[model samples]
Each structure stands twice: as C-alpha cells, then as structure tokens.
Target: MRRAPWIRLLLWHASAAIPVLGAAAAFYGPALERTGGAWPAPLDDVYIHFGFARAAALGHPFSWIPENGYSSGGTSLTYPLALAPGYLLGFRGAWLGLFAALLACAALLDLCRSLRRLLEPRGGPGAASSRWVGWVGWLAPLFVVAVPLLDWSWFSGMEVALLGAVLGRALVAVRRAELAPPARRPAEQLRAGLLAALLVATRPEAIALAAPLAVAVAHAAGSLGAAASLARASLPTALLLGAQAAANRAFTGEWGAAGAVRKLLLSNPYPTPLEKAVEVIKNLAALRVQALESALGGPWLSLVLPLLGAVAALDRRSRRVAVPLLLGAYGSLLLVALNATARYQNLRYAAPSLAMLLLAAALGAEALARRGRLAAGVAAALAVAALAAPSAGFARQIDHFARASANIAGQHVEVARRIAARAPRRVLLGDAGAIPYLSGIPAIDGLGLGGYRGMPFARASVHGVPAVVELIERLDPAERPDVFALYPSWWGGLADVFGRRVDAVKIDDNVMCAADEKVIYEADWSALAPPGERRAGVIDEVDIADLMDERAHGYAFPSPRGGWVIGAVLPGGGDGAGGGGGAGGGGAPRFDAGRLIPEGREQSFTIDAAAAIARGPAVLALRTDGGGPIALGVAALRDAGGEARVEVPERPAGRWSEIRVPLRDVAPGDRIRIRSLLGTFRSFHVWLLRP
Candidate 1:
C-alpha cells in the first residue's frame, strides 16, 4: 500500500465503494436512490412510473392524464423530474436507476479534478507553502464534497450529482484564477463563467451562479471585457428560460413561471419548512448538536450544514464566492412558498453543499495545517465525519432492502409467471411497485400511488378480498383482469372485504383471488355462507358464543360503513359505548384498530370479525362450534376459499367463545390480503348460497 501510486489509490476507492454502490443502486437506488424502493413503503414515491411504461406501449398519450393516485393538478414541479425522463426514454424506475448511476459517476470524476486543483500548490495570497498546496489538493474535495455525500449522489434522480460536478468545475476555475499570472486571469474567468452558466441548466439554482460568474470570468480575461463575458454566460440561462417562456406562453397564459404550485410549505404536515429553515439558520449551540445528528438524516438535518458552513466560511475570496453560492442555494431551496418544496437540503441534502464548502475549507485547512498536521487532520476529520455520518445508516438500510428485494424479486417473477399463465391478456395489479416492471403485462395503475395528491386512480378497498372485488367491479372489461397480482399488504388489508374464498394456487404464503370456476376462486365471496369455505355446510370448531349482527347482513355494526370490528367482548356484559348486544349481552362493538379507513381504499381485517347479535333472534347461531354453515352470517372455513375454516366451539358452551380460523376469506373481484399483528392470521371465506 505504501508503494501504491495515484492509480492504485483510485482503484482502491473504486473497489471498496463500487459493490456497495451497486447493491444500493440495484435495490434501494431505483431511479438512483431518490425514489425509496428498498423500504417497506416503496410504492409511495414512484407509483406513476410503472403506469407510464405500459400506458405508452398501448398508445395512450403520455398526456396529462394520470390514473395513478398522483394528482395531476397544477404544474407539479416533482414532474419534469418525476415523469419527463421516464416518458422520454420509454423507461421506468429500474431503467432510470442504471442511467442515474453512470451519469453520477462521470460527474463525480470531473468534480475530483476541480478538487485536485483547489488543493494544489497554488497557495492563497500571503500563504506560499508548497506543502500546504499539496495537502489542500488531496484533502479539499475528499473532505469537503465527495466523502460527505458521495454515497447519496449515486441514487438520486434528476442529476443532482451532475449539477454538483458542474458547480465543482466552475469553483475550481475560480481558485485556479486566484493563482494564475495577471495575464492569464482572464482566460480562467471565461472558463469559470462558462462552466457556471452551463450548470444553471441542471437545476434552477444554477441560474444564480450567473451574475458573479460572468464578472469573474471577464476579470480572468484581463480586460473589462465583462460586458461580453457576462453576455456569453447569460446566453444559456436566457435561452433555457426563453424556451420555457415560449412554451408557457403558448400553452398556459403565464410567462416562464410554472404556476401549478398552489399550497404553502407551512401546511405540508411533515417537518415544516419554517422549522427546517429555522434549524438551518440557527446552528447555535443546541441546534448545532441537532444539526450534527442531521448530518446523518433527521428530517433532512444534513441539509442545514451547508448553509451553516457557507455562513462560517472565512477568508476574503472565499467570502466573495461563497456569498453568491450560498444565496443561490438557499434561495433555490426555500424561495418557493408554494412550489413542490422538497427538503432537498436535509443532512443527506447537505452532501453536495458540503462538497462545495470543502473546496473553500481545503483552502482554509491548508493555512491551519501550517500550525501543525494535527490541527489540519482534526479539521478535515471533523468535516469528513460530519458529511459521512448520514450515509452510515444507508449502509444498514441498503442490505435490508437487498435481502428483501431478493425475496420480493422471486415473488415477482413467480407472480408474473402465474399471471401470464392464467390471465395472459392485460393484467390488473394492486400495489404495483416492482411487479409491473418485472412482468411484461400491460398494467392498470391500482391505487394511483405515484401521484398520490393528484393522480386519478379509482380508490377502493385495500388489497384483500373486498378490495379485489371492488377493483374488479371498477375496471373496464378490456382492462378488467382475471388474474390479480397483489402485494401481501394490499391483499391483507382488503381480505375481509370479499369473505374467505381466496386461495394460494399460484404461490405459497401468497394467494390467487379470482372468479374463474376452472382453476381460480373469486374475490367477491360476500354471498358465500362462510368467509373461506369452498363447500357449503362445512363446520368450523372454535368456541363461537356471541356474534354481533346489529348492523346486519355484513361486518358493519358500530355505524359509519358496514365493516368488521375487533376487541375482547366483555363476557356476560352488554355492548358498551356505541355497541349493540345479542342474547348473551355480547352483540356490540368497541376498540379502535389503530388504523383508519381512508377514502379510495377499503378497510377490512383477518381477525375474527365478531359482533353480538340478539340471541333470541339469531344471536347465538354460530357461537363457537358452527363449523357447519350457519343460516345468514359468515360460515365455517371449509366451504369458502383457501380451505379456510372457522371453529365455532359448542355454541353457548362457554360464557365467551373464541372462533378459530384456519384459512382466509375474501370478497368477489378483490385480491387484497390481511393478517393479525402477530403475523398469525386466516383470511375470510365466502359461501355463495347461504349455508
């Protein structure tokens, strides 16, 4: 290692980091990490992507029409970034992920060049230390930019790393000019101004790099050719804005302003913008500690570091340059009161900012190093550690996703094969995160998740029995899928909606809720005697004493929507607080399941959906041992699908009876599944002819 040269060092860096980067990119880095796929809630961020792919293949215009739950309301800024690239490349998240990784790597290499120059022997004014320059060259970028957020740069979509590279090059040009002979300064200025202008194209903030950059470039040109230099620098910004203006003028009535944004950041309900900005501006003692933690990722804690670093960067030339850069960064991050205000600068958001700040800090650290290598090492360590902190969690997080993806990928492949074998013609999917991409079937956006706020998707029950049934009812016949590939989450949530006639023919620990009598069961099992019985007159053998029937017919009782309820029914006591009772004083309902029923999605459960109806009437019918199909309510597990069986102990045997179920029941046309908190669960079964 001691004999290792620059190439060797570079290779070492690549060897150690690339595998980690590749794993992250493949699993969590879908669309380069910005779209969080490696998490439990992967679908929420990039729902529209899968929808757009199949939609285009079918010749549907990539029109403003959005069926995914994404609101296509105003000029949603998350668009161009969110939708445009997918549309342009005819690609989806995974495809984009591959592209993002390459682009970012290229940009990072260029940034390394700028960093090397800043740290080179061209010492600052009054500081002519050759050793200092050498140290600066190597440590500036390593400590400042790349190491801090290098990991993050690999995954984010919309080219943040590329923008970072451009910024790095221009800043390097500035530092290079600072040391150039008086005669060569003008040439340096032109390089800086030109690079700055080009960077503006990557992000809206790049435009601000213009004014100061133009003057700086002209200064490098040696003459007061500031007018011409500024003109040239301004050209890119003008043309870009001009094109937007022309399009905006042609389409809507606004000038270049994208007027689609309507709400203020204060209202978003997450880490409010006011709180975040205050956090960024007030890196006082206590807040400073907090910012340090965010350097790893608290509501984007890392983002504030850049602003604080910019505020703290000293030295005359640095002050001049950092002021404009900081202004533009802050303005771009917080200027929009109503834009798609992404917390782009949180701790992880701080990665690039840290990179930029490192350039200046390297210059400063070199001076400090003169006191002693110890002082310089301490300074660099602090900066580098702060930047690398948030990325640490990413390491743990990436593996968790990689393993999960490996499992899910297998499920997706099997699910796709099953769907292709069964439903061949256009398949409809529920919770379509990676499935549609894995399967080649033309897909319909299930929940409109990608465009959660404005994308138009028919909201139905979750992915369970009822949701599947409801979904089937809502889809067009052409798009009406016979085979439904559902995430266990969706299926589990809506499993109770259909009863229990659901099955797992295609995959184990998985289900196939269909209506085909040949090889499939239906999602709609409401008319079935029991929730999961395939045959009528089947008998489950659990203790089923009190059954609630106040709401009548279905699982509804405590008002609102007629749905299921769960709680420990107080034995011999009557239903309390919005509950009705049956013969054994057990027909009411209580207990908040800690979940709410949102519009567009059904709310069902896999537990014993109990209710106490009047014993004198039909209250104690299938108390515990009604393994046999009862007259009106839910049936035993046998007749419904999934070979589901509910054990009704000798009804009226014990004061309180517990109904034990073996299989899940479901509704017709639904495919969602459900489970209990303990992971131990049984789906509902439906008996078509009242058992």
Candidate 2:
C-alpha cells in the first residue's frame, strides 16, 4: 500500500512543477491576450538571448546579429545555446518563449528533486520511511516556487531558473561526496566538479558558489592532500572558465563579456580608484537593503529564517551540508550585489541566491522539527507563515510581469514592426534587444550591449552627449547608422545633431521601460560638417575629447595629479547661463565636446608637426570652453630640447573660443601641453596650422 520511492520522487517533482506552470500561465496568459497573441517577454533583455540564439541557430555562435560578427553581449552563453536547438526545430516567434518556459519548468522540477534529496537523511534504516518528512519535502518545493520574485524570474524567459537548478544539483553532489566513504569520494568529487563547471557556464557569477563548494569537497577528501583535492574538485571549473575567457578574447578583444564590461562597476572607466571603491560600496549597501526589504516575506522573517539556518550549522552532523549551503547562498548574493544593475529588474539577479537561502532555511526548519513535538509545531507554523507572507506580493508580481510584457509589446515590438516596414540599413537604438530580434534588421546598440565595437559607445554614453558626438564624428561615415530609433529624452543632443524625426511610438501605464516614447529618425550626417569658415592653413586636427583620438595622439594626464575625465557641453550651453558666443548666449559654439582639465592640472599631447614646421610661421590653435584662461607649454625635442609658454585670456562663461599661439623654432616632434591656470575648463580640439 506504500508508494514506491520512485513514485514519491515523481510525485514531488510533479507537485513542485504545478505551481511554476500555473504561475507561468497566470502571468503569460493576460500578457499574450493583451498583445493579441503575440509573445512578448517581461524584459526586453529576453529578446537579446533570442537574437543570440537565432544567430547561433544560423551557425553563428556568440554573435547577436549575424552580420555584426562576434559579440559577447549575451550574459548566459549556455542559455542561448540551450535555446538554439529550439530555433533549429522550428520554434520561432511566440513558440520561442514557450520553449524557454518548458526548459525553465524542467529545471524547476529538477531543482525540486534535488531539494527533496537534500531534505532527506543520507543513508540509514527508516530514514526514508517518515511520512512527515515526505510531506515536509513536498512543502519545501511549494515554498520555493511560491516566492514571487523566483516565480517572476522563472517565467521571465531568462537564465535564473536554470541557474537555480544547476546550483541545487551541484550542492547535492557536494553533499553526497562529503557523506561518501573515502573510496567513493573521488567519483562524487568528479561529478560535483562537472556540475560546478556547468553552473559557471550558465551564469558566470556561479563561480562564487562553485569556489566555496570546491573547498567543502576538498575538505571531505581528507585522504588526498588538500592541494590535490582542491585541484581535482576545481579543475573542471577553472578550465571551463578559462576557455570562456579565451573565446571572448579571441572574438571580442576583451577577457570579459560585453555585458560585464558595460554593466559591472569594476570595468567602468572611473577617474579615480577611490571613486570606484566608493561606488562599489554604495552598490553593495543598496543591494543588501533591497534584499532585506523584499527578498523574503519582509525584513523580520528574512532575518529570522537565515539566522535559524546558521544556528542549525552548529551541530556536527548538519555542519557538512549547512556550512556549504550558507556559504553558497550568501556568497552568490554578495557577488551579484557588485553589479550596477543588480538593484533593478525586480532583483532578478538575486533570485537564485534567495532560492538557495530558502532551501537552507527549509533544511534548518526540518532540523528544528526533529527535536520535539512542540518544536515541530513551532517549526511548522513558522514555515507555513513564511510561505504565506509572500502571497500578497505574489499577485502584485504577476500583475507587474504581465503589465511589463504588455509595455514591451506595445512599445519595442511596435517600433520593430515599423522599422522592418521601412527596411533601412543599419539602425541605431538604445534598447537593443526586442527591436533587433523581431525586426530582423542589422542594428547597432547605442547602449553597447549588442553593437559592433560597442565599448567606445558604452564609455561615451557614460561621459555625456559631447563625447558621443566626438565618437560618432570619428566613425568611418559608411559605418554610421542610417536610421535611428531612440528615446529622444535619452539622446536629445545626438538626435538634434544627426537625426531628423520620422515617427514616434508612445506607451502608457508603463512599469518597465527606459522611457515613455521612442522616436524614429532618419540620420542626417550633414551636421558633422557645420557651416563655418574653413581655416585655410590648418594642417592637423586632434579631437582631444574622443577617447580613441586621445589615445592616438599620445595624450596623457600629467603625472602626480588627478586624471582628467571626459565632459560635455550641450548645444544651448547646457543649463543656459549665457556668456559670450556659447550656445546659451546668442550663438552656439562650433565644437561642444572636450576633456575636462581640472584646475591646476596639465594635459599633454604629442603631435608630429613636421609639415607645420616646414611651412613658415606655424601656430598652435586651441579650442577651449571660454570660462577660464589656459597656459600652453610647447617643448621642441628633435635632438635637443627648448620650451616656451604662451598664455591665453578667458572669454565669457558658457561659450567656446579659439586662441592661436604663435610657435617660434617649433621642431617636428614637439610636445604640446595645456594647463588650466584658472578653474577647470574643457579642451575641445587642438589644431596645428601654418600662418
């Protein structure tokens, strides 16, 4: 009359999958209906993976758009690879989301089975015979699937669910190895290593979990020396991680993926190390606060359950499992908090970590229940209350998900349709995901996620509009996007300079979009050559504002000083405090982009001025923001060195001006350096001209 072990296992997995599927249906049903049966993901980022998958399916792995040639934009390399098979098998469009959903559900089922195994006793008589234990195991999965954020992540068409599943399996494998006899530990260790590698491939942050789990596995393999054991347990992970880095380097010219370079604070071009450290600390604090508030059933239960789980780790019998679980859970949370985007998108980055903590809490509850009938009752009450606490938020999460999906469908998808109808060559846009995928148009990501040579764009965007303009101006002209679809508010300067508005799409009641409106424009590059008098004797021009140009000119922020950072002056003089011929005044400056040379700091550029030297009466022309005066130092060093300084007077604030400093006996390899004698000022362009 007793159910078979396999039957119970099957039932538990089925039970766990029911809520996940039900939640998916409840969330996606209204969204699909709202979009008129068109599938739209809750996040635009979902379509990013679809784009990569489609490229991979067409035999171009790692490329977001096949023509873009090798992009490391997809964060989860394995997820797109997983979805690629679906694309090959004819699961296109709406069916793609369904395919992803099935994969997530399968992962959830696997996670449930792993959790149930972790909940059960290792090996002994009557260990598997307890009815209460079986019921608790069944309820644990329900608790996991019931958390609103986890459910949101599972159905969001991202890699969160698969990550959880792989992480759970890896933990189970580590635990099994710990409990195995010495003779059997090596095989278990190898299995754990393989799963850990897969975990990293699924999500690179899984390295935090995998590293601690490796240490735990090594501790268990006592007969093998610690170094050998650690190597054995960690070998697969290191190799896989190394291979990913090598592949990224080979294709993208970066060791890290484009997503990491664009999103992580560590990779950002911070002017100072101290500033980077401060920003990182702030991000970590913010993520922790968010987790405490919304990660569990509110702050109190969130604090209590994890504490109880830590308490359960005191017992030697439970220490083996509890220690590793605790480390992996908290470690994963710490790792994700370092990301700039961790606090956004409903904390999707932290979902896998929360699941691990919840599972650990469930185990702790089971441990408490084993003490006495009173303890068991108390544990049962707490567990049920924790599960019920998230119910209020569950409905809200579902509504948000559906509404977010609707927003993407109405805005990005509609824009894509319009764009496809136009069929322009090489579109440029900030939101790069759904539009590029759905439209089948070759596009450049203005935000740099999926663009060709996107890093410069990413850095330029961070600095401001002037930097973006300088970079765009330097482009080969043929490579510039002919059409642009962008949120005008996000790129007003760029739009004004190069885009002629064609159409716009607006979405209302939006919960998840960068802006309310996305405007389409025909790119007008004529602005690159603004109508102005050409300087007749100009021999060389260097755009000091552009990072690429700065490097090419051997530009350097002088030693023992704070480095200069890229800054921009918008047309109309930014905030509009009028002075002289600045944009805020009666007229706009010819150039509005430059690098900010801080007060009392010098910036130097090496110029090969051989032609200017050969031409009689050569001069150096400097274009600078008119707010402050500057001192120019010229050093001529062909074989011997001679130096001279020239001072320029300041003009009105919020304006730009050109000052021509005559050069006497200037040689071929002369170095030009400028220092702000007054307050910080922007250096727009430097030109060597023959008078």
Q: Go through the candidates in order and give each one's C-alpha lDDT.
A: 0.39, 0.72
**lDDT score for candidate 2 against the true structure:** 0.72
* Cα RMSD for candidates in order: 16.8, 5.2
Clashing pairs in 2: none
Give the C-alpha miss distance for residue 310 in model 2, angstroms: 1.3
lDDT of 2 by residue, 60-87 (tens): 9888898888787788878999999999
* Tens-digit lDDT string for candidate 1 (1-691): 3334577458545643454345344545442232234322122123233344334434432322233322222222222343344446655434644444455556665666655555444343225555433444454434433332334433443345666677778777766655567677656655665666566544454555555555544544445355665565455557756775665444433243322222233322234456645644443322233323443455554543453344334544454455555555544433332233233222333333434444444445544454456765664555555445566565544444343333443344345556555545544454444445545555554543322222123222221133324333334444444445554444443333332334343323211122111122234322212222222222211111011111113331111331232212223322211112322323332111112222222323222233222111111122211122221223322223432222222234223323322223323322222222221121122112112
RMSD of 2: 5.2
Each prediction's TM-score versus the true structure: 0.45, 0.86
Alpha-carbon runs more than 4 Å astray in model 2: 128-132, 267-286, 370-375, 453-455, 529-542, 552-554, 557-592, 605-621, 625-628, 633-644, 650-673, 687-691
lDDT for 326 (candidate 2): 79
What shift in Å separates residue 336 of candidate 2 from its native position after superposition?
A: 3.1
Determine the C-alpha RMSD for candidate 1 after optimal superposition of all C-alphas. 16.8
Candidate 2, residue 221: how far the Cα is off, in Å: 1.4
